[model samples]
Target: MKRRKVPLRMCISCKEMKPKKELLRIVKNSEGKINIDLNGKLPGRGAYICHNPQCLEKAIKHKLFERIFQQKVDKEIYVRLTDILTENDEDI
Candidate 1:
């Protein structure tokens, strides 16, 4: 069997390259709305972050999303992301 290549993405907070599925994706759609792309199939500009809360905080503190999206990220988006993370953490 041929060896398969794994898709990799860099975490904006940690600056670490990791398998795409291991990170969470955030996307900005055509309407300029930002959302967490849980399925990773949303059509839009995407940025990745690690599953850890520390990475999420670093990204927020440094305004990584604003830089990546080229616009201000609404507070609701951050709230939503944090909610999602906490929910996932509880399940683990």
Candidate 2:
């Protein structure tokens, strides 16, 4: 018997391919709302980023998140994104 392969996703910030379950997924729903998808089951355009503050900063500074979503990100949302990154770091 063969083991199943794990799905891999590329991080928008670091541009590194990592296991999907290890990275966090940020998604923009049909209504153009952006939020973190903990379950990775949200239906919409999504972007991947490592759970690292440095990557979050890079992605925000370079507007990579906006590029992935094809829309300007809300300032408040970016703040929340950073906060979330910090919080995730605390968990580790």
Candidate 3:
């Protein structure tokens, strides 16, 4: 038997280190499209956020995506992220 290593990621909003699987990923693809990477396998530059709404709101309020992606983020992207986060919360 072998011990498995857990991948850790930092939440951009909360600045907390958590297991990768527990964080939501957002990616900026090669074509410069920003999207929520629900599968966490999207090919692009990625930023991590916690599953909590407070973290999401903090990220949006601070415009962390703009700093992460180095460009302006569309309002729809935030809306979509919020929708997805809330939807996932309901399942918990």
Candidate 4:
């Protein structure tokens, strides 16, 4: 019998494996655009987090996104990301 390997992703906030798609993807493209990878098809360095404001807030507060992307996240970008997450929460 052979064992199947499960695909796992580390959540930037809780730092646990929940699954790939279960976590929202944050991608930094070659051109240096940081955005949520809703389609999960972008080619770049990626980070994962749960689709919750609290998780996102925790990641932002601890600067985990910067660590994951290896780039300096500007204050304005942080503000926009928070706003985007807030809107997503409302839609959910």
Candidate 5:
């Protein structure tokens, strides 16, 4: 039997590749609304971020999401992502 291939995604903040299941997905839809896709099933342009505080900070510092989305990303979005990262960390 062959082993199933793991899907890999790059963390927008750190620019590092990691398994898709290990990262959070943020989506930009047709209406340009951005959302945090917890289940990885949202329909849109999705970007991944690892569960690391440092990565979130770096992305915020350099406005990484803004570059990818081609729009000004709100600070609240980063804050929310930070909260999610911290929550996930606590779970482990």
Candidate 6:
């Protein structure tokens, strides 16, 4: 039997390529809704980020979401991302 290949995605913060399952996804939907995508199956444009809080901060500090999505990110979205990060940390 042959093993399947794993998909990879690049983190917008640290810019490292990692397995897709390990990265958190953020999506901009067609209706202009932006949110954290835990399932990684949402439609529209998507960007990847590491679960690490530092990477989240760097992305926020540099306005990376704006650059990639070409729209302003809501403060609430950042808050939600931070909350998710904390939850992820607690799991470890």
| Candidate 5 ranges with C-alpha deviation above 4 Å | none
- Top-scoring candidate (TM-score): 6
Give the least accurate 10-residue stretch of model 4, judged by summed lDDT: 76-85
lDDT of 1 at 87: 69
lDDT of 3 by residue, 1-92 (tens): 99999999999998999999999999999999998899999999999999988899999999999999999999999999899889878989
Candidate 2 yields a Cα-based lDDT of 0.90
Between prediction 3 and prediction 4, the one with superior TM-score is 3
Q: In lDDT terms, how accurate is model 4?
A: 0.82
lDDT for each of the candidates?
0.91, 0.90, 0.94, 0.82, 0.89, 0.94
Writing each residue's lDDT as its tens digit, candidate 1 over 1-92 gives 99999999999998999999889999999999888999999999999998877788898999999999999999998998888877677776
Query: Residue pairs in steric clash, candidate 1?
Result: none
TM-scores of all candidate predictions against the true structure: 0.91, 0.89, 0.92, 0.74, 0.92, 0.94
Query: Candidate 4 on 7-89: residue-level lDDT in tens?
Result: 88988898888878678888898998887777889888888887678888898888899987788877776676677678778
Instruction: lDDT winner between 1 and 2, please give it.
Output: 1
Candidate 6 lDDT tens digits, 19-51? 998899999999998988999889989999998
Candidate 2 lDDT at 50 equals 93
- lDDT score for candidate 3 against the true structure: 0.94
Instruction: Name the TM-score of candidate 3.
Output: 0.92
Q: Candidate 3's error at 72, in angstroms? A: 0.7
Clashing pairs in 5: none
Residues 9-83, candidate 5, lDDT per residue (tens digit)? 999988889999999899999999889899999999998989988888888898888889999887778879999
- The whole-model C-alpha lDDT of candidate 1 against the native structure comes to 0.91
Higher-scoring candidate on TM-score, 1 or 4: 1
